[model samples]
Structure formats: structure tokens, C-alpha cells
Target: MPEEVIFESESDRSREEIAAYLRTVADNLESGEGITLKSDGDSLSLDPPTHSTFEVKAEREGPEGGPKELSVEFELEWPEDGETESESGELEIE
Candidate 1:
């Protein structure tokens, strides 16, 4: 499937700032609310269904033994036309 970019923004931020943003999203999700993103007059709203796929990934990019970049990504995916979620093993983080 072709991927489409809706709204995106990236910038340097403190750990507390990042955590606050994540907490806001988590709160809305728990209360069954849609997420609305607004930046520079561009806005996007996303309302994920109850049953969706959640993915957590930890990755290291860049050349080996050189300057490396590490990242952790959290994603939620669900079918727009039809509902489907794949199963996976349990994930634990320390």
C-alpha cells in the first residue's frame, strides 16, 4: 500500500517535554477522544478504533562503529476499509 504523509513535525526537545506530549495522547485515547494535530495552520485529526495494531520498535541507524542514531518508535495501525490486527509475541521494556 502506498503511504501518505499527512502532518509531520520534528524538533529537539527535552525528555519531560516529550513525555508530556505522549501523556496528552494517552489521556485522550483512554477517554475515547480523537487526536487533533495543528501546526502552522495545518491540521489533521485521527480517531483510532478500539481494536487496532500497536507496534513498538527500537532501532539503531547509521554506520557501524561510527556515528550512530538510536530511536524508539510507537505506532498504531488499523485498516481504514476493514478492521484487522496481527498478533505478535509479548514485548517487555526495562
Candidate 2:
């Protein structure tokens, strides 16, 4: 199955900023480089970072009866310096 990636930000930054940042991150991912950014209400999440991510809630028929919802969390870890690394909270998916 193809992996889906999505990005969401807290109710702080503007939509334009979030979109720009996501675009940059996507570019970096395409180049096989790790990206690190300080939390500013902006975040990104991906299923595999190779396919695509949707902002809308996705639903599927459950095997038993009801509907099933699939949610995922993603973290970004970037190398800072020699033996030093930085980590950030999971990107908001909602």
C-alpha cells in the first residue's frame, strides 16, 4: 500500500507559513536529507514520506461492522553536530 503523509500546525501560525514549510520539508525528503525545525505550531506527519498525506480524516469499513479510523504519529530527528542531535514533538495530524 502507498504511504500517506499529512501536515498540521497548532492554532498559531498562518496557513501560508505551514504550507511553505511543508513544501521545504518535502523537498528535503526527496533529496534524502533530514530536516529539523523548531516547533512553531507547524508540523508534518507522513505514512512513509514517499507517497502522500491527506489532511482530511480518512475512514474505511470495519471488518466487523462499524467504521475504522487510522491515525499515525511522526517525529523528526536531526543531527546537530558531532554526537549531538535534536528532537521535536510529534507533528500535529489534526
Give one clash count per candidate, in the order shown. 0, 2
lDDT: worst 10-residue window of model 2: 77-86
State TM-scores per candidate: 0.86, 0.33
Write one digit per residue (lDDT tens) for candidate 1, span 1-94.
7899888988899999999989999999899998898878899998888767888989999987899998999998888776566576698867
Off by over 4 Å in 2: 1-11, 40-94
The reply for model 1, stretches above 4 Å from the true place, is 85-89
On residues 1-86, what C-alpha lDDT tens digit does candidate 2 reach at each position? 55444444445568797689779877888886656644567654432333333233344545677667564334443222323223
- Superposed by TM-score, candidate 2 places the C-alpha of residue 18 at a distance from the truth, in angstroms, of 1.0
What is each predicted model's overall lDDT from 0 to 1?
0.86, 0.51
Worst window of 10 by summed lDDT in candidate 1: 80-89
Error of 1 at 14 (Å): 0.7
